[model samples]
Target: MDTALQTKPCRFGDKNTSDIVICLKNREGIPKRFYSHSSVLINKSKYFANRLSHPGSNNCIDIYCSEVNYDHHVNLLRLLDLPTDSILDSFDSVKSAVGILQLAVFFQCEEIACCCIQYLEAVPWEDKEEELILKAVSKLGPKAMPILARIQPVDLAATKDVFISAVRIATSIAGPCPPFGNELKTSAQEQVEFMLGEDEDAPLVTADEEVKSVLRMGLSQIYSSFEKELSSLLLEPDLVSERAEEKILHSLCDLEWMCNILGKMDLMKDFVSNWAESSSNVLGVVENNKLDSFMWGLKIKLIEITAKVLEAVGYGNVILPTPIRLTLLKTWLPYIRKMKPLLDSKGSQETGFPYKMSEDLCQSIEGAMVTLVLALPSNDQADILADWMGAEQVRYPDLSEAFEVWCFRTKSAKRRLVEGLDGAGNATVSL
Candidate 1:
């Protein structure tokens, strides 16, 4: 037994008796040097073995490498410091593994090279790190791939571009049909899609079943997350955290964006309808809601989603059954009254209240409901207006004020319409 080896770890490469000096450099032409022993480098790398064969009778050699990443090269030296098979004995992080792979291939260290490739293969690459690993592998090319035969850097870049284009098309402000639809009909976008080789030409109907399944699952998860979020928000006494509210809204918007891309307008409508139905179902609890602050804040958020969905789908597209219709309108009626002076005068200024929806969202819901009503028979419209006013016997001064604003404006408009019809009738009789 070697008593010296048993008592203390052997410092083969870093010891004072090291026979070679290795200098490495980065892309910026800065160099990093390391102490090396000929035996270790020779046995581990055939390239090093051939290159470092003869230095001088003084038994010293210098090896400089300009092709390696400085950090990667340093890591490679750390791996070489240990027995070759033990290079992967400890897994630090995926990042370090990838870097080690790059260095192993560069130095022609076959044993550690095998371990690096295996480590990458066995583990998952994080989404954020996917492109980084791909780029590293691309730079290594055939040298890094012990398992695969070849890879195309251009193909990788093209695939990445396609992914980015898909995400952009998915998330951009959608047209009526939304997502990557009808927008491709425009020559400029068509040309752009064509240049990028994006398959805008392919009909969505032909989307692979696997793809559709994944999309459906994604939408389900989003809705589940939204439901959980509502509960979380409800638990908070003061849903006054604007940032938190904005984050929740943005996440819902992201899901809507996906729906737009999938041409799932029905899906979008169904969510709002279901939410409204769900709201109605939970009315007892809501009325019994002890935490008025959370209840009021939640009502405002629910109204925001409902209003946006209706506004976005256009009034004619959605059938707002009387209960659901009144539910939405009543939600905003107080705010409407509060903003009566501004809304009646059609002023640009906004109104605010503690338990109120944002002015813009309140206006959107009000406008959506108003447009639906205007398209109805005048009698039906009036009855709807009556219900708005008569929903409760209490002093709904806000509701009264809101109705007065609408009644005066709509009555004169209707009067002018009646006069025109009467005038046309008289003219027809003469004819």
Candidate 2:
């Protein structure tokens, strides 16, 4: 056979061609033996070099390994005898590379260890494998930096720069989504969420002041574009154009996406405030226009956004000036009430409405509306409840809680006034 075609290229375990006996001492089984050259062992491994350098000549060196590590050690021993170019071909997976790296580190074999590091640095790792690599490489000295580079903390300025760029793309105020724009924007949105995720691990990036500032700027840009779109629609004739609806709907969708990101960062107050200021105008445009039945989806989206805003305000997550708060409630409550039955009627048709209102969302809106109405001053509460009582669809908002409270307070009003006067008299005498 030609030398190139010989199967035993390394001639590693062939006793006929070997000069030294290498012993593999396993924890439980009989020690295994491998045939090797002293020159090869000394040249390939520093550990073997130091061990075989005793004052008296010895033809044997023993390597100890646990049962779990026996295969790795055997493979590594075979690798030591492999041609330098063929070394990487032996260990294929991340687990094998990591195992060999641990042994290479112990054997003080720089060549094999360097190859392992290169392989790990270039390959993608699964989640658990990443953890394993981190743990294994963490114990190694500065030589392992290549493997850690992917997980290391990036410079703060660079991180912020990338985030701001993504925000600009995601919240771009330009007209309807460009070619592949939705996909690109969706990707950007996902990255933003991932960076700020708190589900499994801590957030990759902290939403510090700088990050918040970028987000707020993006939010403002989108809202400004949205308001302008709404204002233009108000001035236009009641004729419904697909182009116009697309423009308005696109902006609303962007705002909805922003709501989710801001909610995660606890920055809902900015959104709630902006929505409060814009609520009257938003509802005004909708009421003025005669939208086609297909436009019912727009109303559902508005309710979804309004539901989030009401939840924030009603639960006091976002506090606002009393007038703004009252305006917000007044603007959205009637719109929601008006749209509910309309949407239900449309949904009941044979064709069926594509956008069905979420029952949970309706419940959330009603609950928030009740909490919000009750929190208002007595006069405001009376105005809201009186309006609710006269509405055709009083059955849904079910403001019985606010109604009952208002009734009790009104009934005891005279008695409370008498007690207040009596308390004032007693305080004056005591003084």
Candidate 3:
């Protein structure tokens, strides 16, 4: 560890009062020399004891360090003289403690290492500091297990339990949410999203069949509540109950949130199926009612959800029977086409709460509708394209792609049929 250096004199103990000079050397510039007591060094650090045990004429120890770790090495040497309880007090933050812990581990100074660990384990860390702590402690092995315990992977059952609890709180929509309940639900919902999210690592919850089943159960309850609200609203379409309207809005919001979760888990098939099956009834409730300004938000929310369902079906992400697919389009397409101009008109007005549609959303809805139309049987495509061609407001959905495809297919149908008939007639002579 010995290296020749242009030394700067610093003393942990008084000059000439100590027999040993500890030289801390960095790769560049002048190395620092700390005047210290042999008694304190040998008793505190095993690394020092082993080095000092071998007799030499000049009692000096050289320790080489990187520029980044030079200050930590100096602080650790100073901390060696402090009492065990007071040693932890020197650590002002997790960053400082982590820097010291690395050298403490290398220097075989268990006391300082223990103090660093203690200080770190007791204090809170910023996100980056936590990553630094993990990197530092992971190199020190089992000796730093106390620090790692807090972040270590827990029992699978325990993790699933916590995830399930969060899901329950997030999706708890029975009667009415209390004033503070929304905040709690929001927090839970955000955490549930985090657990299920994937960025640098895999999602926290494995989302096996059991987890998916739990999610499905929660979604079923939400859908049930939403259906009940819609059914009740339909019973008296003319009568406007603010309370009932609010409940219906909240339920739709819940369904919208569920779409995100279910989509991530690839469990959207059931949700999309349910939405598709109920599209007619859903449209009926909206169509029969006279929509006031207050109802525009509700209508917009329904359309937003329908857009996601449309995208899923459009991309063939969620496969459905042809009839259901046809029904879904038939049920919602007219309403969507009608609502666009109304929403735009309302949005342009100087209202307190304007109902605006974003360009991206409009494009997405248009693209999805086009894809959905193209996915249908040729006759169904022809029917949709015919309707789209004749409609007064055909600019929104713009089913030209489907129309062109139908036209090309329709034009070639006769030639393909005649070719098939000629082949059949030619084969008849041999038979």
Candidate 4:
């Protein structure tokens, strides 16, 4: 019997054994227990195997202890078991610190994760070893959620590229299906939104004189370039004669151009407020019969433009002025209420742009109205208007005094009837 253990030539400690082969052999019937004196050799085999199998494993601390030779593992584990204060003062490298973090997180190490996150947060973005930081974060999982939440938009803006790079590293370490995946997704979206000027309703800078000066200079240059074309468009005789929808569309284009030229200035709030004040003056020029029709569509377009501008500026709660809001309510809503019957009566094919246009106009108007109402001061008039319009009063109960004034201005117009009367002496309305 050949009892002289016919073992395969063991390159047990050889770094050139190709880590994959070591792992495969370890899995192929290695005894679970070995002599204490042989632990050094046994552990080296296991370490080589694990490293080969998980080459991309980023958690250095975990990998170090589980895969290193027995004496090295004991030494590192002893260092990790030191008092928290001492551990803070003495770590050889980020890799070693990260290893400790991995061990802590794997064992539900709350205090360890907390301390690591604090240290990692304080590390300068440029100086910190990104791979080690990401590995620590990946292992922290939901424990990292609060730390992530505390990251300020301003800080993120400064280190955006670095942050994105770290995010990719962390995702790779945590694997494709991470437990805290949604948290990462939310953070990414928020960062993008912030960068695109979606975090606030006002412009990025308000009182910065340098920014304002540059803005004014840019606006003057743009106005100089496009003034002639814009004037020609406005002065064309066909503008007044065109269908109200066409005219309103052109006006919307003009507004967009103005917004662009101003470099979408922070002063947009003031500009829009002033524009709203002047809308009544513009409305005065149209003939009475055409005025209602023109305003009906114009108000809807105005609302759409308001929403677009507000969204662009990042002011989620900015409202159109009361005059514009009233114009929408009095001119557009009643028309839509009347037109709904016509839309129902005619088959979809027979309903031309007038019907389809009116529906789109109403939807945009309603959307703007909701936005405006949300920003108004809480009051009875706002409540009444919201309720009359069949809006949910609880969500937006406030109505500004400006809106009330608008309601007063448009009250007679909304209630007015045409000359001809039915048997009840009320004017026969058309869709």
Return the top candidate by TM-score: 3
Pick the winner on lDDT between candidates 1 and 3.
3
- lDDT (C-alpha, whole model) for all candidates: 0.55, 0.82, 0.82, 0.43
lDDT of 1 by residue, 1-431 (tens): 14544355435456664666676655565666677666667777766777766453234433445554456666676666577557677557788877777667667788777787777766776778766667656755665564242233335445444534444343332222335353542433333334434365432222355444444554555566555665565565555667656655654555554444444324454555645555543343434445333334444444455566556433656565665655655444444344334333332433544544456765676666666555545556577677666654323222344456567868898899999999988884433
Report the Cα lDDT for residue 228, model 4: 33
lDDT of predicted model 4? 0.43
Candidate 3 lDDT over residue span 354-394, tens digit each: 56667888988889988888888988988888887799988
Q: What is the clash count of model 3?
A: 0
lDDT of 3: 0.82
TM-score of each: 0.48, 0.81, 0.82, 0.30
**RMSD for each of the candidates:** 13.1, 5.0, 5.8, 17.8
What's model 3's TM-score? 0.82
- Distance (Å) between predicted and true CA of 327, model 2? 1.3
TM-score of 2: 0.81
lDDT of 2 by residue, 1-431 (tens): 23432543546887866778988898765688988877667888898888789777588777778988788888788888887788877768999899989998889888888888888998889998988898778878798998888899888778878877787778873433678777888788788877776787556566789778888988998898888887887565544667767878988988998998899877999999899888887887787646645466677888999999999999898888888889898888888788887877877874855777788998899889988988888899999988999987787777898899888988799689999999988884433
- For candidate 4, what is the TM-score? 0.30
